[model samples]
Target: MELFGQSGNFVLINIVSGNIDFDLRDDNPAPCENIWVGNSSTAPTDGECI
Candidate 1:
């Protein structure tokens, strides 16, 4: 489905691992900053964005 945020737009799909794979795009594309997304049950320890 289409996902919109303050950063940009994205398309997310479900994966076998019960995780979402998102393809993000932006008008002014640049390196993503501190973005992290994952299942709440298993989050990043270092606060690093995936």
Candidate 2:
């Protein structure tokens, strides 16, 4: 899909089954700081910030 922000910051997470399409605008020129992709029902326990 698409996401927009005033601070030009964003994050994306894919849990199960799907595809992510990111469209960044030149006006913001910002990139996603963190991204998580997995297929686990439990949370991450490796000291991650999940």
Global Cα RMSD, each model: 9.0, 10.0
- Where does candidate 2 stray beyond 4 Å? 1-30, 39-50
1-50 per-residue lDDT for model 1 (tens digits): 21234443332342223334333222332354424344232321222133
Residue pairs with clashing backbones, model 1: 35-49
RMSD from true fold, candidate 1: 9.0
- Which ten-residue region of model 1 has the weakest summed lDDT? 41-50
Residue lDDT tens for model 2, 1-50: 12344343333443432224322222332353334344242332221322
In candidate 2, where is summed lDDT lowest over 10 consecutive residues? 17-26
Which residue pairs show collisions in model 2?
none
> In candidate 1, which residue ranges exceed 4 Å CA deviation?
1-5, 8-28, 39-50
